[model samples]
Target chain A: MSGVKQRVPQIILTVVALLLIASAFVARPEGGSAPLGPRLLAIADQEFATWFSILAVFAFLMGGLNLVATHLAKIRERGPDRFYSLVTLVSFLVVLVIGTAKLGGPPGLQGDVTAPGSWLTAVFDAVLSPLHATLYSLLAFYIASASYRAFRARSLESSLLLGSALVVLLGRIPAGRHLTAWIPEPLAFLRVEELSLWILRVPNTAGQRALMIGIALGVIALAVRMIAGVEKDPRSGGDGS
Target chain B: MSGWFAPGTWNIALVGAFVCAVIVFSVIRSRRGAMVAVRPLPPLLALDRAVADAVAGGRPVYFVAGSQDLDNMQTVAALAVLRPLARKVAEAGGRLFVPTNRSLVMDNAREICRRAYLDAGRADLWRDDWVAYISDDHLGFVARVDGLIARERPGLCVLMGFFASESLLLAEGGHHVGAVQIAGTASAVQLPFLVASCDHVLLGEELFAAGASLEGDAARLGSLRGQDLCKLAAAACLVAGSLVATLADVTGAQPWLFLRDAFLNVFRAG
Candidate 1:
């Protein structure tokens, strides 16, 4: 009985996966076409999509609850980081209350939580947006530091990387264009801008495309393993069958 | 026929079916004791060293499953890699912390770590607080992680999954704290940032392959082999297509053009 019970979920998963794959391949019936199979598959696909959206809402709720619980525990422990936890809880509750009550909007639950003058909108625009922007701006400094370390011509690969990066960076500016303006028309292809464009369009694109293809193949293999029930469920934690 | 297979998608269906068949066959062969070997990934080795260092240093190991939800395949791959790492941390008697942006992922991550500890006979060391649900806001999550890294000063930081701009922040934060960092993602745009900042980085499909290699399971290894075969086939097609297209462009031959289009049509959507 226990074995049977365990197999049931696997069976359901396999069936659902197969059905979804079939649905994706089979076209829906057109006007006045009475194919029952394709129509049924299409409906199943739509239903699954709907179910997923519903599940996503619940997942967010669960996440919100977990966040609350975690912060509460931290506050109760009076740890060194309890102050940060308290700030997070306060921020979360303020946003949640303002958004739920539709405060400072048209004054009803039906009003938009993000209406221009609403408290939620103000919080988002005045606080959250600036914070997001500030954090994003930090990437510039991080990039400079990372580039300093990576662009050092220590080896053959690093030399190539440094050379190409130099060309690409310099090629984008007016100085690079002026530097190469003395070259004859016949040798224009060797100009910095042209070289940079060729590098980006040819080798860079080719490498990116090859990587994408490899990633796609990997995804397919993983999906096949999952649909075939060969993958060990992390929840089960079994030495894979 | 149109109703049987969607327009512009039949080619995809054919490819999908072929790939699925190949993977399934390989998996069956593996289950039947066929030998499969995976090339060593340095990032995974670095991950092992990181765990050992954390254990020796008595500092926690932090695993960041980038700011992506469970629906993303990259996130799934991240979780796959996490299972083995968690098990290692558990057996080594080292602390492991996972901060996630998605609740669903947080739940799954907690389960994986719990099972790992249980399997290692260290369930008592597993704490619910180990996997915390961070904020859903992108930068907010990064800020919290930055703070965690600064405060805790973890010895090892393993980042795997889909990341956007925050990839740099997380990696740089780890770098500043002198943590041994191993990062992996299939996102091509983010790969350069990680490679530059991380101690070791897994490029593209290597992230997926890392998970399979770490599992050391025949079935997953077989699937990895099958994926390689598909990549070879794809490369052949690309070379052939490029050659035919180039010849058509140079020669202005009708037959060459026809052949090129015919070949390209097999892969193109309607």
Candidate 2:
């Protein structure tokens, strides 16, 4: 009895997953030509997708509560990072109030929260956008630092990578094309641009495709394990049987 | 037939079923005591070491589940790895912090961590705040996590899952903090950044295999074996198809062309 009770939830999960998969693959003919089964499956798929979206919205709400609780605890503790937590809380509340109330919009709750000149819109454009852009700008410096480390000719592989990087970098510029312009038409493939293109189109593409195929197979296997209930359920909090 | 399968998807359905059958069969066989072996993944070993070191040194271990939501397959695989690692950390009395950008992922991660601690018989050590949602905004999450990494200076940073442009910032942040970083993701675009910045990297499908490799259990190993078999079959098909297509193109042979088209139609959607 205990085992059966434990298996109940897993059975339900598996059934729902199988239903979703079947609905996704099964065909639905157009208009009245569609059979009842396929048509029902299509409707079930749409309903399930909608249900998932609704659940996601609820999850978002739960996350907001979690964020508030966490920052509030930090503030209560008077830790060194309490000030930042306070700022986060205040900003969250301000945005939530502004967006929900549709403040600074045309008027009334019917006005769009993100309408021009709205408080939320101003906050997004003036504060959030700039902050996002500033963080994004840091990527340039990070890339430079990463490249410096990656391009060091410490090993054969690194040397090859460095050589390829140099070719790809130079081939993208007009100077590289000019340098190779003197080459005969019969030897045009030896030009920097041609070589770079070949390197990208051939070896690079092949490697990426191989990786993609491997990843795809991995995904399929993992999905099978999950659907078959062979994998451990993290929510159960116990080691696998 | 068209009415029984979605247009342009019958081939996909057939392939999906075949893959599923292969994986399921392998799993059942292994469960019945069939032997399965997987190649060693160095990053998983490094991860174990990092956890032990953190426990001994009384420092925190940071786990970043990347910027993707739980819906992503990569996030599922990342969470799978987190289960054993979290349990190990909890058992050894080491602090593990997981900062997530997506709310759903954060919730799922918290459950996983909580379960880990419970299984370790150290439920008291589990804290809901350990897996916190920073922000859904990409850069905002990165900035906050970067600050956290700098301030905490964790001994180990385990970055696993799907990441985008912020991959380097996070990895470099760990590097600057002198943390032993182990990063894994299937994102081709970000692999280079991770390879450059982390101590150990799991490239592409290796991320998916990490959990199974760490677990070393029959079912998981069998699944891994199943994936390998599928990969071999795919390679064989690719080679055969290429040969047939090339012969048809070079020789303008009607028989070769027919054979190639028949083979292609078996795999081609619609």
lDDT tens digits, residue span A78-181, model 2: 99999999999999999999888888897775677788999999999999999988888888988998899989999999999999989888789999889889
Per-prediction TM-score: 0.96, 0.96
How many residue pairs clash in model 1? 0
Q: Can you tell me the DockQ of model 1?
A: 0.77
**Poorest 10 consecutive residues of model 1 chain A by lDDT?**
A232-241
> Using lDDT as the measure, which candidate wins?
1
What residue runs in model 2 are displaced by over 4 Å at the alpha carbon? A1-6
RMSD of 1: 1.7
Each candidate's DockQ: 0.77, 0.76
